[model samples]
Target chain A: MVNWIGLYTLTSREVGRFFSVYRQTVIPGLISSVLYILIFGFTLEQRISEIQGVSYTMFIMPGLIMMNTLTNASSNTSSSMLQMKLLQQLPDLLTAPLSGIEIALAYIIGGAVRGMVNGILVLLVGVLLIDLPVHDIGGTLLFLFLVSWAFSSMGLVMGQIAESWDQLAMIQNFFLTPLSFLGGVFYSIKMLPNWAQSLSYFNPIYYMINGIRYTILEKSDSSVMTSLWMAVLLTILFTSLAILLMKSGKRIKQ
Target chain B: MPELAIQIKDLKKSYQDVFALKGVNVDIPKGEFFGLLGPNGAGKTTTINILTGLVFKDSGNCLVFGKDTVSNYRFTRSKIGIAAQELSVDWFFSIENLLFFQAGYYGINRIDAKQKIDSLLKRLGLNKKKNSKLRQLSGGMKRRFQIAKALVHDPDILILDEPTAGVDVELRHELWNYLRELHNNGKTILLTTHYIEEAELLCDNVSIIDEGKILKKGSPKSLTEDLGKSGITVQLTQESIDKKLPMLDLDYSIEDSRIHFSVKNPELVIPKIIQELTSKNIAIHSIKTETSSLEDVFLSLTGKSINE
Candidate 1:
């Protein structure tokens, strides 16, 4: 059986967990977004006029939204799972009448919700602060949701593999953070040399940034179809891997 | 035949090369209070984990209510609730909220679980701290909350692994009373502990396990009567201490100017020993006889103290 009630309860608990700590989970991302806008968007706009058809401050809004979305989304699941493992609370969930898929799905939904909330809040900030345009509101929301789901699943994978807080930080600092910055978040890949542009194509996060950019600004360095396909592929890939690890009871089970 | 609540056949589990359970077999009938008594590293927790589906056995069958734990996990798990040995809980959650969530995990809705949650809190004397986060509770409160969480779903069988380990005497007694009440209400409980007193007090049957194998299994009274031995101690005077002991055809050892003899009936042998000592001119300062307990049975079977 699907255990819908169990899944719902677990997902709500995950959601309530982050909601209870709004100061730590929600405010920090919004505050960081404002800082990025004031420091990078305003100051750098005076030096460089506009990247696409929009002002420099407006140009970086999509990237800021993507950055906050993926970061919060991934961190929600990673931290939650890792903390439960470290505290030895996993046996409660494991011994419950929930299947592996149900558990993973609950975690994914929790992370995705956090990710989407942060991403949308950043979008609202951009629209209110700088009058940032939304070329396709429906497409923008869909893209944000896809990116959140994908990164949240990936975060569960990282959480399952890393045994300690230090290891999780290493994975986030060395991998996710670097990839987000290099994924052409602040600037388009066109600004990069041909060699760097070729390397950017290999960064999956680039497609997420490019996809969100297309929906919000109606402008993208890569093909719109390519970005959409990349988001879909990554979502399926990470979700499958998360479910697999959960079913095998890797690390979380003896 | 009366629908055993738990059954294990040749249960074996190994971590790397070291075995945690080796061909273990046990059957616990419905509504029976069973205890698995063993010291540290004796596989008590491992056996509980296997039965609860938190661990996978290398090769064996663990059936709860006649359903295989591995193949029929949903049914088996839903019927058995476990208060694990480790204090594993989310510290951020309040006791009430955690109980609600636990009930929800068992497919019970909020309204359906409220009464059970309230009753458990009141029964465990945790109603006052219902809103307190788990981290803010004391050790004894945390233990009670663990049991509450396990019972919120109202499973047929409750498994407590070392429930009273490290608890104070008063709280231990309180928990024992609550557990006894639950048992009287027709709840089957499987209790594992190294405390011989706990097993003797709470369990109807006990299996004495040592080093991943069960050495003896029976009622506490039966085991003590069958495997245990009574003994008499005679404190000798200074001059008689060095004298050769009487040829009593029994297991006897002399230490610290006292002669100790292990016999079945201390009353029958005490007079014979007193007469033998008098004839040898061994002056006895005092004499004391002791009856064997579960601890003595454990010592005799394992050849060492249970706590050792």
Candidate 2:
């Protein structure tokens, strides 16, 4: 039997850890996302006028929200696990009456919550500043939740793989952060050269942004079905990989 | 009635090219206070890790509560609690929350977890600092909180892997009292420590390991008696005492400016040597007796000092 109580407890602890440092994990993402929306969406839209039949401001808002969600989601799990590893506390959790799947799920759920909450907070910032319009509210929320789960799962995997702080930061800098910006958060794929646009399709974060954009603006640069399927696929793959690494005690064992 | 709380049958684990545990076998019975003595890199922590599911075993098997640790891991883990050498508590969480969450990991309900956390905090003398963040607490307090986290679940067995490392004597003594009380109540405990005195004082049975192999296994008293012999040292006023080796009457030698000899009974032989030295006009500075202890047994068996 799965220890439901133990799973809940581990999830609670993971959630509580980020909550314990809300000012660092939550507020910073919300502030930075809001600033991006203001400087790029509102200020630049005046000169750019419109993109793809919608105001540039509207087109960019979804991307900003997606970026923040993925970043926060990924950072939440990675930093938490990395801190536990460095502090030598992972053994405590390992010794608990918890299974590998339970541990992975707890971390994934924790990261998802942070990602979604930060995503919503950024959306709220856009709603107030750019007067953001929601084309489909339910789809927007669903895409946001799914994207959160996927990136958070990715973060758990990265956290397990990275041994030190510098290593984790390197992954974020070289991969997550750069790929996020290149994924069309600030520029539409159509605005890029054909070569860059094709490459953007390969960037996983591009699909995340495009999926969220389709939910909000009811328009997508790529096939909506493809974006949705990729999101689901990545979530399952990363989540399963995280659970496998944990079960094998890869780099997690004393 | 199952006699064993934990059973290891040729348990083995290796990392890359180094073997941490190589076919080590041990059986710890219920309610027994067992000590695992080893120098650094001798597989003590690795053994505990495998038992707790933190690390995978390469070969052989480990069982707790008569259940295989690998096949029935969660259930076996539920029966065990471990306080590791490192401070593993999250720095952001308060001591109270850390303990409460730890209890919950054992499937304890909220109300019972709270009660258990409160009681453990008090026993560890951490009630006043329950709401304090871990980073704010002193080293000793952190050590105590680690123990509190381990005991929060009230597992059938407790494994302490250097729980008192770098702790002060006062706090160590306090923890000893609490652990003794727990042991007296029929709780099985397996302790691994560098402190031979601590092992001698608390452990009923001990196994000393070196290079991932068990060198000696027995009670502290019996192991010392088997591996080491008592010696009498007769201090002399002059640097040379070689002439008195024959007069001392029992195969003695002067080495390092002192006359010394192994004796079955130091009480009987020490006095006779002192009297003989004084009557021979040899000024005796002081006479001392040395008895075998766990350290001596460990040194004799391992051929290396634990302190080194």
Candidate 3:
């Protein structure tokens, strides 16, 4: 019970820490998503009309939301942990009565909240600019929450292993950005060739994006069951790895 | 029962191939201000890190408040607070916010935290800078704020790793007074310092360590008094004192215009030396007597200067 209270306070501090800089954390993503909608959804509408019976604008909205969710989630956890490390404030947390599990959950939850906020903001912008229709709002929300949770845990792992600002930037540049861009953000899998479609199936972001697309557009190239199962697997795998890293006091502690 | 606040036996730690602490043994009793004195790279930081659970030892046992550090880490850590040697705080956070956040980490409620924060801020002279961003404060103010942050949780034991480094004399004195007050309130403190005078004044007991080992451990007075060897100096107008003051039963040497002697009792030997010099009709320009100090004891025990 006491551990839960510690976790709650820690999570609140982590969340509040980022929100205090909301202009940098939340507003830019909203503006970026609006820009994507204007340039790619409207400007390129003439080039590609519809994908799987849904308008191109509506089809790309879920991908954009997932992109924002995963990026924000991962960035929130990784950057918070890295900042604590750089400032040497992590010792305060480490010396507290909280356990490693509590610490891990606090960071992951903070990431999830930021990711969800960014995703919702992107969704609201999509609705305003492109009139995106919601097919299954419940499923869409569920998928967004799960993806946020998964990526936030991944971010915590990255933050632990990263030793410097350059190393942190390298993870985002070399891994996260590429995975996000290639997760079928602007195009459907049917539009790609056989080999490309096969390759897209291997990217975990593909499942996240397509699963969310299934809920928001009612039209998905990937199977919903497969996507859901893949997301759950990724969440479990990433969360377990993050917890293990924290428990072992990997690069973060000593 | 008088509790043992900290105990370590055969503590060892290494980073990669470089050994930081090797076979260290120490015990600090409750309600005492203990000093760990060593030069840079002498493993003082490593010992504190291990006690704080920021670093794992390669081999050893460390107990805090009667609980094993490794097995009962959470309980052990909850009783201790540390102010690291480095000045590390979030530049974005105001002093008040940083204190509140640190209090929150220890599961202190906001209502209680605010009360504690206000008192700590005032005590540390940080009340004026409570709302100031950490980066905006001067170096000395930031250092004081760190001490305030460490005290917010109100742990039973406080460990300060070179807390007064880079602080000016006035602020250092202010900090010493604050720490002394904390000690008077029955808090056990473990301090690591480079300033020998600071240790002599603040610590109730001290240990001198070098090359990852303890060279001496005792009260500052006892440590200095135990090195009772004294030195005497005499000056003459002539450079021929080397021949005048021949090798006697006492240890003596001549350098330039001065003659130097080392004896167990300066009072018993100084009169005899003066008589010999007078009988020889040597003009004594000046005479001085000196006894061993803590600095000399440190050098003799560590085989190296403290500032080295």
Candidate 4:
């Protein structure tokens, strides 16, 4: 039986946790988004012109949105879970009537909420400052939700695996950040050398960036369906891994 | 017969190189105030942890109300509320939020949960500090909050692991009174404590565990009668100090003008001792009898103090 009340309470607590620290969780993403818009969009637009028919400023919006979504979603769960573990407060959840799947879903929903909120806020910033025309509002929202959910699950998996803040930072710095930067966030794959483009095909985050760009700009280098499928696959992969780890009592349980 | 709230059979658990529980067995019936009496590393907390699904047992079975704890964890967990030994809390949240969340975890909705939480806060004397974060509260207040959290869910079984370990005397007595009231209201409480007096005062049945093994189990009175020895000390006059004592078969000692006797029954031996001393022309100055306590029972069973 599902514990609906427990699940709701846990999810709300997670959301409220990050929301309470909005200065640290929410504003940083917005401030950085504005900075990127000013530095890369306006300053470089004069020299760079356009990437794929849209203006240089317009082309980077989707990538910026996805970047914000990915970072916030993943960080929310990873930090929350890690802090709870380190503080030995996880017994509150473990000893509760909640099952492994219910716990995982609550955490994912919390992360996804943060992810979606930050992603949409960045998109709104784009719309407000650049007068950026959104191609499809519904599709953009759907894509944001899916990507946020996927990355949130991935964050939970990371949280389960990483033992300390140093370990978590290592995973983010060496793996997440590098791949995110290399995943065509700032430029199109067409601009990269052929070798780099081939490597980009191997990067799952590349598909996420590609999907969001297509959703917001109505232009893409790859098929949007493949991007959607990749998002679905990542979501299943990380969510299943997270639930399995929780059930097995890997790191969170002893 | 009322079903046993807790039943364990040859339950075993080991952590790496050390064994925390080695073939331990215990049964506690419904509405009974049971205590797992032990020293620091006696596996009392480990047993509670396993029962609450926080730790896994290496072998044997543990059941809550005839339901296997591991197999029926959801039902078992929902029926059991535990206050852990350590102060495990999220300092960021207020006491009210913590209790509210705990109630919700047991399937209680906000409306019903609020009433219960408010009553709990008032009962625990924490209503004034409901909005205070854990770090802001004193150690005694935090301890009270922990109990409040455990009771918030209103589980069928309340497991308190050293609930008053670090609290002051005033709070401890208040907690004892509150616990007695809870027991009177028919809440089956399983308490684990190293404080022998606490166990003797509160528990109807106690299992004295040491080094992960149960040394003895019974009511405090029965255990003292069976395993403990009473002591009788008689202070004699200076003139009788040099007199030869009677040939008593029991273990005894003489110190200056005092003669001490260690016997199973102080009541039965006191008259014989008085007659024997009187016949010998020994004058008695004063007499004192000490009843065997649970501490004495624990000492006689384990060859050491429970506090050690």
Candidate 5:
């Protein structure tokens, strides 16, 4: 009744699409994460020495992992959807007897898979780079998955809104990229002024970064409980929006 | 009288203040090679899109195999395979991979899908290019691949929206032959094309649509017959041809050293005209018969050529 086979095909297609261009999709994120570890984790950590009783390398490791994970997840869905729309391939899936919810779930789940893979890869890279500890592996994985699902769903919404490659690039370059970097990836929010610290609470990526940081190093500038709730809320929020847009055929129907 | 494969009743859809389908009604019986002929902006593509769930209709009902398009959207879609005018397959995957994935979407298993895809590739002459990426394919190859994608699921109805838009003459003929074979094997087909000749040759029943409404509907032969008569022209070396040929009870006109006769049946009328001209001491060079074609019927109904 659910057309499970169709759902599997779409998910496989979406996932295989990213995998087809591993040089662009998977390798870039891995290389960036490794570089961040080498330059900042190795060099900058020497200056900062320690933040909240952990080395700065360990402090930034979770943030780097979360950053690359979410970025890859978001890029996986947004860039793929935008390409399909421009190339006129979206109609193939649309006509494939797949329900709107099934289509959205396949794409979102595909993004989440990419996100989780890159996150785990970065985590492994950090373990090798600085011998980063795993204080709570289960919690880290669950949070990584939730963040991936949320960002991927957000990417779907972005893809629906964008009409061309230029518009897609603007969303990624101006919004997603800047938000991830400024979401306290490099430094803890505790170092910011009180006003800036208050503002950091609004950046959803902040909760993700701190949440993973709490899992790996058992250190945080935000409450783990609050971060968990924020991740769930964002996941629900973005997934619902994606489904609604897809079902209504918003901005996509001819 | 027959089972309806596709039934549209007052289907309406308007986009950007332009009505793409204004109360369109058509019933495609099972196993009929139906043609929906229309010029550009004639809503043929829109009709296919709505049936496939790419576009939502503004009003009215579209049913495929007794399943309402909205209420049973997935079931309706699973029954129809559409080869759209625009190339819509993903460039990311190879031809074989794309077909395999497409088959899987229709719930086909890997082994069955692989066999079906292989058979399609061989039948479509795409075996050599199976491994090639879509971007690496020629325009003709891309068209062939589009057809293959649509057939991967083996749907009950195949909707071809201008399947041979820019294909070469030889390939177009081959494609028509393949489509005819499919129709003979009990596959329902709905074709839309600008090439009236394609429709003339391949369609069992056709509906000419213009401005989002049906202007004419009948078999190509029947439609041509409804025009009542064909034209016959004789080129004469000597032209004293200002005479109405009273022998055949028809009117004759002359232009460019040729005498034109409006005949009800050229086969029966040409010889009589030849006899009458010879008796009148007219030198006849060549005689030509221009039978009324679907083009003529289209012109009479729509007041414009198919290409226009």
Candidate 6:
């Protein structure tokens, strides 16, 4: 049988590592989310007024939450792995009785926790600033959990393949940032033309944002069912890719 | 039979087009202080990496405590502690925090991990710096911390890759003394170093590898004795002694006021060499006698110096 005690200890260490660096991982993201809310919600509210049926502030709250969650989750795993690698402390983990699954799970879950913390912090801040209401607390929590898990796995994969600090930054700059922005973080698909809206349907982040929006504001650009299924599918896809990369140990083993 | 802590058979590894290990074989019995001796660019680090499961091999097999390293990695790995060649501790973490995290990685509870961490830091002379961040510690202290971290798990085998590379002589001796104590306590140690004298003093058995191949493998005494029968050195008061008359029946070179020579037997040839030199009225200042060392054997075998 696998050692649950060992898994828990490792997972705790991973979580603690990120928590210790809250300034870089958590606080900055929270501050940025608040800034985005103030600037986009109030400034743009005068021009656009409302998105779908909800106020612009409420419409963008879910997007902001998703953006913070995904970025935090990815940064948590990537930074942790890179630090372990650079410090040469990764050998300690490799020499342990823990399997690749255990290692991957520890990192992914650590990222998820950080993501959730930042997401909740941002949401709480949003409530204070804009009076946002939760239409479906259960669905919102579920979407937050799934989206965080998916991005965290992606971060782990990125960490393993990255050989230098520059490579790690490249993943964030080139792939993650673009995906988050295009994932409908700032604007709803309903605001787009028919063709652009159809294209947004393929963006996984769009589903996560819309799903979260449906839960929090009860007004989404897409159906709740479609968003739920897309979130689940993306989670499975990203998790499998992460696991496969970790198992191969291609760039990591050296 | 004593249990073999590590066994390798025809192990081979390659990186892209460069082969790192070529059909290398070795057996390390439990509780022995073994040294993997070689100069830079040799396969010493590669061998350690393979043993620790940080790198994969192209072919051959390896077993740790009789468990296959490839198939039974988790179990075997749990019994091994590796202090990598590079200083690999998180610079952002405090010394105490690093140890606690390492202990946790091995599944130790917080209560038990605290005890182990305290004892290790004390033994390593790092208790005062427990709260110091890794980046703030000196190089020697960082190296010692790495060793302390490795030992937190209390594995049966301890692999130290050049643990004393950048440390001063005193700290190096302290480190060696600590390693000796660990060996005395029945821990199987696989050490790699460029210092031949260090290997000669601490290792019970050694393997010299070069260019991804084992050049020689045996106990230090056996390998030294097998290289050549004996050696002799004659110190002269003047460097002009060689210009006065040609020395006979021996090949010698004057290096730093000393004339050194190698022979099958120093006792039988020493008297003749002395008489031959004296016949020309060559005045001698001092003389010394010795046997071949691992350095000599390595140079003769690999056609390259250990420090090369």
Candidate closest to the true structure, highest lDDT = 1
The true-structure Cα RMSD of candidate 6 reads 4.4
Instruction: Please tell me which predicted candidate would have the highest TM-score against the true structure.
Output: 4
Q: What is the TM-score of chain A in candidate 1?
A: 0.98
| Model 4 clash tally, residue pairs | 0
On a 0 to 100 scale, what is the lDDT of residue B233 in model 1?
90
lDDT of 6 by residue, B1-308 (tens): 88999998899999999998988888999999999999987899988888778888899998999999889987788788888779865645688987877777777777988887899999999999999988888989988998998899898999999888878999999999999999999999999998998899999999998988988889997888788446789888775465565547677766767778877556677888788777877878877887667998899898878998
Worst 10 residues of 2 chain A by lDDT: A33-42
In candidate 4, stretches whose alpha carbon ends up further than 4 angstroms from where it belongs are B238-257, B265-282
Candidate 1 off by > 4 Å: B231-289
User: Candidate 4's C-alpha lDDT?
Assistant: 0.89
Any runs in candidate 2 off by more than 4 Å, and if so which? B231-288
Candidate 6 interface RMSD value: 1.9
Clashing pairs in 6: A87-B88, A88-B88
TM-scores of the models, in the given order? 0.92, 0.90, 0.91, 0.94, 0.93, 0.90
Candidate lDDT values, in order: 0.91, 0.85, 0.86, 0.89, 0.87, 0.85
**Pairs in steric clash, model 4:** none
The candidate 4 chain B region of ten consecutive residues with least summed lDDT is B84-93
Can you write out model 2's per-residue Cα lDDT over B1-308, one digit (the tens) per residue? Answer: 55899998898888899888888888899999999998878899888888888888899899997899988988998899888887764668787887777888888978988877878888788899988889889999888888888888888899999978899999989989988999999999999988989899999999888778887899987787678767888787764454444455586766777778887567777777777766777777777888888778877776778877
TM-score of 2: 0.90
Give the per-residue lDDT digits (tens) of candidate 5, residues B98-181.
Answer: 888888777786788888899999999999999998888888888888889999989999999999999999889999999999
lDDT of 4 by residue, B120-152 (tens): 899988999999888888999888888888888
